[model samples]
Target: MRNLFCPKCSERIFFEQGRCARCSQRLAFDPLLLVTRRLEEVKPCSNRDLIGCNWSADEKSRYCCSCALTRTIPNLGSTKNRLLWSRVEEAKRRLVYDLCRLKLPLKSEANQLSFDILSDDPEEGPIMTGHSAGLITLNLAEADDLERETRRVAFREPYRTLLGHFRHEVGHFCWDLLVAETQLRGPFRLIFGNESQSYENALKAYHERTDRSYDRAAFISEYASSHPWEDWAETFAHFLHIVSVLDSVAGLPLSLESRALETLRDPYLESDFSALLASWTPLAYSLNELNRSLGLGDAYPFQLSSVAIGKLHFIHMAIQNGCGISACGWRAAPVPVG
Candidate 1:
């Protein structure tokens, strides 16, 4: 995302800020305009007071573009649940911001996109996180750092986060919008393998496997080994990850003069897949080293092999195809730069 300034005081503000720190003025983020304005200039989302939402609602709706996509939210009677819901919604806002900026379609004609966030029922047991048709379900407990980390370790995942979950699940929704019935399905199959395989059996076999066969060079994550659909989803999530990271670091001057991104192209605006990946490789390494300097784990823990990179390229093309955008001349294939 690009830097946003407050319309009132012109003070730099963050995406999640509801008030400008410099002037103590009320602020609201207009999704349609993608700008920060005085609160009185735009209608705040209905969720503003309820959840402290900082985004603005469109003229036709009471909720912000992000809040409008949610069909169900976890019970908020308890204060604990309300806090958890807030964190989840914040992450969702970031996801929607990226999607809108990328010009990706949100809902398929046949299936309107939506989200359901729920906690495990006392008698019904755990609520699994997955996508069906156009609906994405998230386990409410995922907002709890301990719970999410436990599951991540149990599943042997290299990385996992609230935004990651949102990106991964939405990959399923985009499949319906961009690939399932489109011409891209053929190429998708070639790269991701045949998604015609039984997802249920694949998931079962994946969890039941004893050998560490999945942490290979072929897939982004071991869970991606479950099915072709999963492979696409995982690759799609990584695609978002790279874009988000690159966007955050755009135009930053690295100490390593050779790796500085001061002249890097914007990831969301870049049409060439190879160029985006080329910029990301050095930036990701710098991010990991920065984290190490602070005594933290690698900021980006996964490595992309050549096969994984090819799958990512397919995603880049699929997104371009889905968005009805075209590129030519220098835009068609940008020369890679570190």
Candidate 2:
């Protein structure tokens, strides 16, 4: 994200800014926000008023790029479900923007990445959040703060968030599209372990295990230790989180405070993974301290070990191999202004 400006008044604004604060001019939803709004129709998604999605849609389509990928959303018959759908859509839009920044292919040869944001009803049984093939399912209860926090504590997770879930689940889908049956598969197997292992057995054993104090030095999280696929997904999510935060940090005037961030590059476009680590370490510490001051737990609690760094580097290379400068088959990101 960059410092957005109001075109009308030249006042500072934000990507989600509906109206310029200074001028009160209405700003249209930008599907391709970093560069410019491709406002062919100047029309908002049909969901704009219903679910509060503000992205623009082409005249032929009722949905925008983000909303078009959603196969299903929570039932809006109830007030609570409507609120949950709004929150889910908000996070999904952010995930789509991040994928665009990474220059990854949103649609594969046959499998187009999509989402099912559904709710668990008392009579309908519970819905588990996970990924399959190209579809990512998210439990709508994840948007409820109290319920999410309770699950986070119950699972003993270092951190849990709606966006975090999207990143992690999408990581699984990326593995199928980017890693499976590719040259990178061999290297991925070596690093993340062989995915040929029975994932069902791995998951079942993981849940049946009594010990919860296993060493997590090689994994991003304990759940990552369950299976090779999970290890890859967890590491992948962490990499995306790192890049997203670094991108936001680059947008700020942090160079004035830290020499480490003086020559910050576009994190999404940066080739060197170590460069991201260098800027991230200090920022993470500062953020953790800030959270501590407010009697909160560490904002970033995951400790990056050498093994974890290697996994992150693998993800970095995978991204570069797909969308490196001067050779990206896909479009390069335009000058990010938001």
Best by TM-score: 1
* C-alpha lDDT of all candidate models, in order: 0.81, 0.77
- Which 10 consecutive residues of model 2 have the lowest summed lDDT? 288-297
Model 1 stretches with alpha carbons more than 4 Å out: 251-338
List model 2 lDDT by residue over 1-338, tens digit each. Answer: 54456667775444555566566776655656563232343687888778777678756798988899999888878999998888788777768877988888888886789999999989989998999988999999999989999999998998888888998999998998889969999899888899999999999999898888766778889999999999988888888777766665555534534434443646776677887777786566556534422223468976577788899989989888877454644455655558
In model 1, which range of ten residues has the least summed lDDT? 251-260
- The per-prediction tally of clashing pairs is 0, 1
Residue 88 Cα positional deviation in candidate 2, in Å, after optimal superposition:
0.8
- What's model 1's lDDT at 88? 88
Return the TM-score for each candidate structure: 0.74, 0.73
Q: Residue 4 of candidate 2: its Cα lDDT?
A: 55
Instruction: For residues 151-237, write the lDDT of model 1, one tens digit per residue.
Output: 889887878788889889999988888999999999998988999989999989887899967557888888888899998888888
